[model samples]
Target: MQRFTVTLVWVCFTLATFPAQAEELALTSTRTLAASCAACHGPNGNSLGSTPTLAALNQQYFIQRMQGFKDGSVSSTVMHHHAKGLTTEEVTAMAAYFAQQPRQTPQPLPHQSFLGAQ
Candidate 1:
């Protein structure tokens, strides 16, 4: 009984000291890192961007996009540059950050928005 109790106690202590599955930045840190990104990505992931706004996207979708960027499937001069530098952990954090942000409401087109123009 005494040996069993010591073993259990050590096991618990070791588990407590174990590292994370992967490093993940806190949301606050992600936000701080995102300040520069906000210049183009927009505050809270809502960009004043002429390209596309990325605010409030699903976490999975955001992760897919980041992975795409990392794989060179996604095209963007700036995104490529930035994405290349992101560690997988950082990418996950950034994705989580944007996922938590509010999405921007899309504006209706004034003219006919056609799928195809003849």
Candidate 2:
């Protein structure tokens, strides 16, 4: 029937749009939580210099480290305190967000040579 076909199309359209909206909401939630780390970890987990980069770190490793920090198994001047503030679900979301980020390739250090004369 025409009505049945129209109903099926409407259902499919609604279902397709729901996932995109859900994904956007999840991303927003993750970003909101990750924003707290921006000062040290850089935007989206890419560190600038001296600080260790978190971008593209494996999800399991990130989760494990965060859990360790939260539990006092890992020692850091600030991370432990910060980690303790996040819930397990928030930690998982943070890990997933950072793991999805693209990592910057390390630039090779420049070499220098000195001689009195050549």
Candidate 3:
């Protein structure tokens, strides 16, 4: 019984400290694949060009937007070429990549309390 307990502890400890290599690998690959979009969008999906920014979008929002573009639900001749080229694997990677990026917080307007959701 004591040996069983000790082995269980060892197993749990090993599992707990196992390096999170998969996440790192995924991020590296995603960063590479998503690099193509960074010219128009800011690095890591922070949009720098003349379109709606993608940084800070919730993961779900990023996925939805990418999926829409892929499916033609969102129409844009300029974006179509880029979007159509993306595979589900690439889109998922992009969503994960952008989700990991730092989000831009809009500066609060002074007296926003008075603005009341305007």
Candidate 4:
């Protein structure tokens, strides 16, 4: 009876940790996915140029814009192609991730040239 009680307790304890593990895994996956946007959107979605910042954006708005891009409703020079490649789940995850980030102004790059002229 004691052995059975010990096993039950161990099983319960193990099961109790599964949700935390799953949450951690989800967060890691989301972060990995969000990292891909850093190239154009700047780190944590703070844009450094003319590109619109994604940080602290409304989640639903983000999802809608991405969906619009995917469906050809939004015109873009590059976003449509990028948006088309993302699954709905990926878009949602990215939206949620961006929404949670605090928005910050990006500093201008040193010695930046305009119109390709030095």
Per lDDT, the best of the predicted structures is 4
1-118, model 4: which lDDT tens digit per residue? Answer: 9999999999999899999999999999999999889999998999888888999999999999999999988888899999999899999999999999999977777774577655
Off by over 4 Å in 2: 1-20, 105-118
* Superposition error at 105 for model 2 (Å): 6.0
For residues 7-110, write the lDDT of model 1, one tens digit per residue.
Answer: 99999887775543223335567778866686776666676548556677787887887788889998767777888888988888877777777786645536
TM-score of 3: 0.60
Clash pairs for candidate 3: none
Give residue 29's error in model 4 in angstroms. Answer: 0.6
Q: After superposing candidate 1, which stretches have Cα over 4 Å from the reference? A: 1-25, 104-118
Question: Which residue pairs overlap in candidate 2's backbone?
Answer: none
TM-score of each: 0.61, 0.69, 0.60, 0.85
The residue-by-residue lDDT of candidate 3 on 1-118, one tens digit each, is: 9999999999988777666666678778888887766677766566645766666567788778778887889877687677778888888778776777786644453553565675
For model 3 the local lDDT of residue 86 reads 80
Candidate no. 4 TM-score: 0.85
Give all candidates' CA lDDT scores.
Answer: 0.73, 0.86, 0.73, 0.93
How does candidate 4 score on lDDT? 0.93
- Answer with 1 or 2, whichever has the higher lDDT: 2
**Candidate 3 accuracy as lDDT:** 0.73
